[model samples]
Target: MATQQTSAAGDAHGGTDTSPERWVVGVDGSPGARAALVWALAAAARAGARLELVSTYPADFYWTDPYLLDTVRLDEIRADTAGLVRAALAEARRDPALAAVPGAAEVPTDVVVGGGAAAAQLVEQAQGAQRLVVGSRGRSGVRSTLLGSVALHCVAHAPCPVVVVHPGAVQPPPRVVVGIDDTDVSREALREAAEEARRLGAELEVVAACPLEVVWSNIYSVVAPPAEETRARARERAEIVVAEVLGADAPVRLRVEDGEPAEALPRVAAGAVLLVVGSRSRSRIAGMLLGSVALHCVVHAPCPVMVVHPQPARAAGRPAADPAAAAAR
Candidate 1:
């Protein structure tokens, strides 16, 4: 039995009292999910949030014919699924990776069974959660998460911020690395980084990548200005935007690298607790999904990556950001 007390919510996405302070984690008996569960335990502990471990089985992975749908077989699968959840939770309790989080053993947890595909079920559960954490790859392990369909789907569609934990990730470092840009999304990223830093009692470092503008493939004039000057401007922009979004009093380290964001971000994330970045938008349109940089981090960063979603226009409180001023050109 899962030590975490649970009650069937009936509805696929239902919960008795869904709270914003909840961190939802998708668990399977896979090595990746177990690693994700361990990371989420510490993260929720840091954020002072409730932890919910949800295990899902293919609700339709049964017979279609009424006569062929053996009730006993279905019952056995449910029982086995429940036991897997229990064992995963138990192992997480004993994981030394959570030692950084005091009272790790005492963090109240809720175990749930979702009846649907793993990605859809987890996304449904994340609707009311403060954040969603998932493993980059699952049990099959044949494909790198860079191309993992389920991880990609959740990254592009989950309602809340999604933290993708690489199975090979080590314990989170004491610093948070955020990719800085001049856009509204980047400002939002800085804000999230600030909050995460405070929550984890860690230092925050801002990194901006400024690639030299290229005129034409046939022209090799380096766009007039040298790359160093662009990098310098990148440093200045990071300082200004971070101060504006996080307040002048915020203490954040800034690094301006002379490369594209896709290259710079993962370089800085080598040993960081979390890599933070913002997606362009989450429209259903194919081209409007995760930005190139954000996707790269999600797929390759050795540490866990946190992709901050843009708040809706009517989300309240914060005034509209001037994209011209906030975004990098």
Candidate 2:
């Protein structure tokens, strides 16, 4: 295993020194990884953020017995990884897309061996990064991993927000879509989506979903109230989110439908530049890494999905999202 120190070394592209604002992207030479790289480059240009292209492998490549290297030489792996990063950099330079950006010239890029499993390395390396971008699918062994699993891990655990870029997604329309509930995390998502919309000179659409029925499980189940009642309740909840959580001055369009966020959100997000959702929030179905709705959008949204972490504690413990805490903040 290469020492953690060497693993993090950005020596492949000179030294570890990087741009003030950096966005990390895992580059595994897959079509998905390349797409994410392209997106990250354009986004960096827009946000004045630099790019960090990374590829990782098990530590056994260097630390374990020579026989365990699996016929793959460390030097060879390093060269290939560097070459991928270089190609991404070249793409950034040659693409006409970034030519008009004002500060594009200043954003520097670095390629490094993240040194570990794809998800863990990205989450660790992205600690101080502005954002981490990954493609929804990937197909390289050792140095590359499909984002299906890796994207889930990073969105839930990365210190900063995570963006899952879908391959061949049409250029998003002038709008941003967000799913919000009467929860801090959802409110956080709302703000992020709104800000993104504003920055892109697009409309901001806020949606809330309400389940028509309540599942009491194996015990005695109680039927839900009428649709009118549910709609009223959902509307009231959205009002509170807009008033208390979002404040009156925030520019947005609030719409409340059924609380089935997964079903409700993707439809609203259609043709949007981005879909923003909380990793964890107050909802009927929830889990540790990602709430059902967030996961759904990450996998099936029409455009890129930005999973926002509301607070630090839940993410730190990396526990199932707390429903009660939704009101805490």
Candidate with top TM-score is: 1
Per-model TM against the reference: 0.84, 0.75
- CA lDDT, every model vs. true structure: 0.73, 0.68
- lDDT of candidate 1? 0.73
Per-residue accuracy of model 2 over 1-329 as CA lDDT, tens digit each: 24122222222334545455778888777777777776676667666566777777666445557664654566666666677667666665555655765555445577767456887788778877768999887674322222337777777677778899875344444677788887768866765665556555666778888777666573433454668888888888787776665465556677877658888888777777788898664232224534466777887777888988865553344433232232231
Shift in Å, residue 329, candidate 2 = 29
- After superposition, candidate 2 runs with Cα above 4 Å error: 1-20, 61-76, 92-106, 140-148, 168-173, 214-224, 281-291, 312-329
> Which regions of candidate 1 are displaced past 4 Å?
1-20, 65-73, 167-173, 213-223, 285-291, 313-315, 318-329
Residue 147's C-alpha lDDT in candidate 2?
Answer: 33
Worst 10 residues of 1 by lDDT: 320-329
- What are the per-residue Cα lDDT tens digits for candidate 1 across 68-176? 2776765666667777886788888789878768856655677777556877778888886778988888876766434436677788888888888875544444788
